[model samples]
Target: MKAKSESLTAKQTIFYLLLSILLNSSGNGLTVSLNMGSALWTASSVNLSHLLNFDLKPLLVIYGVIVVITNTLLLGRIEPRRIINNFLFMVPFGYLVGWTSQLFNLLPLNQLSTPLKMLLDCFGILMVSAACSIYQRVNILLHPNDDFMQIIRFKFFHGNSTVAMWVSFVPPIIVSIICIIISRQIYAINVGTAFSLLFQGSLIGLADKIIFPSLKHHGVEQAVN
Candidate 1:
């Protein structure tokens, strides 16, 4: 449906993918360093990481693998190419998470006041939302979590993406609650997590509205000329 030149080259695709990974990881770093929670999936992953005394990178990998496996089971076949590409994307993404976590640790956010920390949490959420929006626009290989959500939306939700997305949060929310009960502490499920869960969808949609139309307009102008 689109021209080949409109498609990203391998190098460009890799660049966008890495940039998305960096932005996402940076946001995760900010949230962790500020002792704030992130999105539902991130909160669940953080809880598991803390509970098991494992680093975030390994937990992220395991989560990605689980999502991929779930997707394969649901779809009734393994798409080897897609799976390999997703795995390749995950490796660098996991590394960036660790790298950025360390980078944020060097910051003095720990000394900041409660209000300032909360503000930073919101900023971090924005970064993550923007990163996801960019990645979606790139139209390259998707992260397993995103792919799984899409599959669920199409297969089970009658293609109602909005409802499917909301339903997808249920599992992560349940996991976070169980982790809290087991740990006897609210590890990372804080006000930031609530904010992200409530507002991220709207933010992403807003980003799409802004990004897609501008690209379309540019394409139209070029064609007319």
Candidate 2:
């Protein structure tokens, strides 16, 4: 029974992880549809994709590799199984994002007024933040990008997750700026990018206080136990 419980917990954890990935990808799709910038890392990836003439999927895979390597170096160990699982999960995540992007593109979002577009951008940020909160609360295998942030928080920032999350945006923001300068176009760093940088950390904290607490009471903890 103890072994069975652990197995069930593991399965539940994977389910939450997948759901979080889906939500994150959907939020990303919405961000793309709004013609607004995405979170820093994704925005950087988009710029890199355009600059390199490579498809977003392949670039994401390469970026994931770099994230995994960085995370391993920071943690001083390689959890091969977890890293492989993350990559496997990312395969479907990529497809989901593609499908979601197509669906959002078919919508009338592009025709909405500027104010409405800003509202939609806020909604997208909420979705991404909530997904991140769920992923962190599950406390299972983390995506490499998120894992890197968490490691930095714990190792360097005195476990200040919020500060760490914001700081993680800096490098990507610099890259996005460079891309914009070189191309003479504001490709992916826009108002939405600024909004995400300013507010996403607080939103994630709010989710932790409100959303994650409710989830814990509603069988999530049972699964973990």
Candidate 3:
């Protein structure tokens, strides 16, 4: 039973936006480098990269572009500001994930014990969950996949984060299935994928209450528009 969400000021929006992007990229990078698994959308991109023998970074960018199109369809309107905001989020996020992954790859994650790796993976997911809570509240510029979830959360599911998260996963699940059909293999779908599917939304909702209880969703209309 949280109180009503108040709007974010411009400076607060920018602060959360930057902080969330950093945390999100770092979390994604850890999962990528650890190779335990990733969130389904990221896993789908990895699967598609393997299937097409394409570079993962560019493939990720392309994947974001596709999600942008899907979101546009869902919104049923073409808002250039919203479109540009998503792209702005895409580029830096892609670069940061790549850079962080490469940095972490220099470590000896492979030699780590299984339980330790699992702990690390869970930590990464937590970082992502926290980031989602922050940025989704700020609602300035967001990763397209996050934007998808936000739209579903507010528009269709009546601000039910968990339902929206699960529903938002439909596209990636389809993409992964298509890749498996074509390649007879899977990529990046494993323990982390299961963890995310089960708890990411719940964790995000929890974070809103515990992490920054004062922060609330801002500019929600932009999500539908």
lDDT score, residue 178, model 1? Answer: 84
Across 76-121, the per-residue lDDT of candidate 2 in tens digits comes to: 7776776886687556665666577779999998899988887787
Per-model clash counts, in order, read 0, 0, 0
What TM-score does prediction 3 earn? 0.93
lDDT of each: 0.70, 0.71, 0.86
Ranking by TM-score: 3, 2, 1
* Candidate 1: 10-residue stretch with minimal lDDT: 216-225
Model 1, runs deviating above 4 Å? 1-5, 9-12, 153-162, 212-225
lDDT of 1 by residue, 99-204 (tens): 7877888988789988888988888888777676666556455677766665665467654445656776787888888887888766667878988887776665
* Pairs of colliding residues, candidate 1: none
